[model samples]
Structures are given as C-alpha cells and as structure tokens.
Target: MGDFIDVEQLYDLAMTYSVKLLQALLLLIIGLIIIKRLTSFLRKRFERRKLDPSVRSFLLPGISLSLKILLGISIATMLGAEMTSFVAIIGSIGFAVGLALQGSLANFAGGLLILVLKPYKVGDYIETKDHSGTVNEIQIFYTTLDTPDNKRVIIPNKELSNSSLINYSINKTRRVDFKFGISYDDDIKLVKDILNNIVSSHSLIIQEPEPKIVIGEHGDNAIIFYVRVWCKREDYWTIFYELQERVKLDFDQNNINIPYPQMDVHVSNS
Candidate 1:
C-alpha cells in the first residue's frame, strides 16, 4: 500500500512537469511566429522608404537577429531557466567575438556611416588616393568599383570612410579648360575668332555660360590662349578630344604655326 501511494505521487509530479514543458514549447512557437511577422513588416517598411540597398541589406539581418535573440531569451525564461548564468554566458561570448573581429566591426560601423552620410553612391565616378573608378556596388565591408580599363577594384569601407574622395558625377555639368600655344607672330584676334567659331559649332558645348577665350600668357617661343567651356558630364570627354583635333586642323589650314620650344645659345671665347 505504501508503494502504491509513492507511485501516485510520482505520477502527479511527472504530469505537472509535462504541462510546463508543453507550455514552454507553445510559447516558443508563438514567439517565433511573431518574430517572423514583425521582421517581414519591417522589411516592407524599409522598401517603402526607398532606403539605400546597402543600408537595407545591413539593417534587415540585424533586426531579424535581434528579434530572434529576444524571443530565445523569452522562451528560456518560460522554461524557468536561471537568467543570470545565461546572460553572463552571452556577454562573455560577445566580448570574445568582438575582440577577435575588431577590424570587421570597424568596417561595419564605417559602412553604416557611409550609407547614412551619402558621400557617394553607385554609378558615381570617384577618385581616391588608392583607386579611381565608377562605384559598382556598396557592401557591408567593401565598396566595389569598375575601372576605365575594365578592371574591378574592391576597397575596404573603413579605408574609404577615413580618406578623402572626389566624386566627378555629382554635378550635371563640368568645365573643360584648354591651353593652346601658337607662334608669337600669329594674330591673336584671328586665333580668337577661329576658336570662337570652333566652340560655337560644337553641339556638345553649353552656350549659356558662353565659351571664354583669353590671352593667358606669353611664353618664350609662343603665345598661350586659354579656352574655357562648359558641357554636360557625359559629353566632356568627347568634347575634349574633338576640340583638340579641330583646333589642330584649323591651325594647319589657317597657316598658323604652333611653335616648338627652341633655345638660342651664343658662345664667345674667353
């Protein structure tokens, strides 16, 4: 009779524990479901804001991980596990990982700053001390570039953030300056007229600013003419090359001489 009474008590104990276990499982499932829904909602919200791709990519994963971690702690608490040790273990692990990946963490922070500050964006042509190219992609740790020679460059986010860079595509228009040297005997007024005609006839040049032609300097063998013009960024290179070719051809046809550097030396017996 005593053994039967002990068995009944053992059965009641197992039942009570089984109920707690089931409750814990149910809470875990519900928490996971909520986390998934919330993460999805936040992702859609980010899309609605039209956030930068790099920023969105970085934020979504972080948000999801944070939410999942909170859910895990909640499930652990539901199971009546001691919170103190769990928290300590998590803290220790985080500290160790942080120490091991200090450089990576700095890069991640720099990337976040880049996305928020808007120094340059994809498709912009940028020049830094190390590289110059069009920005192809912006990742969490690195920024990719496509060079003019058809090479790919990967620059660390930390380095990029720490240095100065020039973004050429930020402005819609750019000024193109050219210096041309002609023989001192060449007529300045005639040369100016020819240059004005050349600039005015170019389809790519912006007329609003008005192309400038000025006598810049007198060199030892030649007179330098400075030409300044404005054009759309995309047309800059085309106009640059075409203008040089046209000026050379025009000078040849107009009997203008572009002099070369020459030195006159005299020696007397001492």
Candidate 2:
C-alpha cells in the first residue's frame, strides 16, 4: 500500500457523497412541486375558460404525469448516473410492463376514443349490452354508472366501447312513442280525437310536432293506433307514465274499449 487512509480524503469523499445526495433530493422535490403547480395552473386555466370538463379531466393528469416522469429521469442523470444505459434499461422495463398491462392499455385507448367520439357523457342515460344507467364518471380505465334504482355500476371502458351504446339523454328533446289498441267496433276518428286532445293538453308535451295520433294496424281483436309526442328530456319518464294513465282514464270515461285476445273453445263429442 502506498499510504494509509487520510482524514482529509475521507472528509472530501463524505462531502462529495453528501452533496450528491442532497442535490438529488432537492431536484426531486423541486421537480415534483413544479409538476404539481403546472398541472394545477393548466386545469384552472381550462376551467376558467369554460372548457369541456371531459377534456380538462383527461388532459391534466396525463400532462402532469409525463412531466414528472421526465423530470425524475433528468434529476437521476444529474446525480452522476450514466443515463445512456439507464434510458435503455427503463425502456426495456417499460416494454415489459406494457406487455403485462395490455388490458389497461386497451382501456386507456378506449377512454381516448370515448373522449374523442363522445358516444356518451357524464349524466347521460345510456343503455349498452354490458349495462344501462346514467353515467356518473368517465375515468382512464372504467366508466361509472348509476342505475335508476340507485345502484352503482363500474364497467370497463373497453367493454363499453366494444358494445352498442344508446345515449338517451344526449339531446335536449326526445320523442315518446305509445301504442294503443281499440276494438274494431270503436270509431277510429273518435279515438284519434280523444288521443290527440289528451296528448296535446299534457303539461310536458311539446307542441311543435303537433302530437300525432294515427291508425297503425288492424289486428284480429283490435285496431292499433300510435301516439307520438315530443318532450324535453328531463320530462321523458314523467310524461310517459302520466300519458299512459291519462289515456287509460280518458278511454274508460269515454267508453272506448281496449280489446284483448280471447278465444272460444268447443269440445267435439264423439
């Protein structure tokens, strides 16, 4: 050995390691704070400008996460680690992770499609093969739904996108279709007049379509009529239920017979 260990060299080594550790810690903390602030700022700016909630909710988290990841790698490089191999190492590890999380990646892709295509939005009453409910939240991996009976449903985004979605609440107005059957003996014109009056006088019905009540079909037992009315979306269910009740009451009061199928049987005696 050329010489014994010196206190000065040990002191310098300790000082160097301390400085590196401190720098790494400081850079990490600062980078995280900056990422947080930037994301918060972006979200507020979008919200203040009245941007769509879906856009804001999706973009902010993504931008923040990406920035933090990049900043962390930069800090790691500054702490005396060779970033060339580090980058390749991280890339390979990320590739393996991506393979492991294939389903999650697919869900994320589905979420992007949902956001872009806008098949449905929060609070929209949607029906799909997987489930039917009012959408409460649209997240990266899943979409949350609340059913009519107050049940919470969480469906994977991939499944939702793969199926047909019926978004009932997307528009401001909706048409309500109702069918009624009357005895063939009943006057068609009289039935039409009663139905028109009942539909037009309803509080929720819109007058623009003019409340159509038309003869639909002639069945064995009864003549069918179709009643269609347009109303605001919020009033759909209420108007639907009220119309059924009101129409029945009106038909009963006017002695209009609603016929049902009946058969007379004769037994042959031999």
**Best of the candidates, lDDT:** 1
Off by over 4 Å in 2: 1-15, 260-270
Candidate 2 residue lDDT tens string, 162-267? 8888999889999999999999888888888899888767888999977788888888788999988999999999988998999899999999999987889999
Worst 10 residues of 2 by lDDT: 1-10
lDDT of 1 by residue, 42-139 (tens): 87897898876666666776777888888888778777777998899889999999999998888888888888887888788999998999988777
Q: Model 1 segments beyond 4 Å from truth?
A: 1-51, 54-87, 262-270
Residue 89 of model 2, lDDT score: 89
Q: After aligning candidate 1 to the native by TM-score, how far in Å is the CA of 56 from where it should be?
A: 4.2
lDDT of each: 0.89, 0.87
lDDT of 2: 0.87
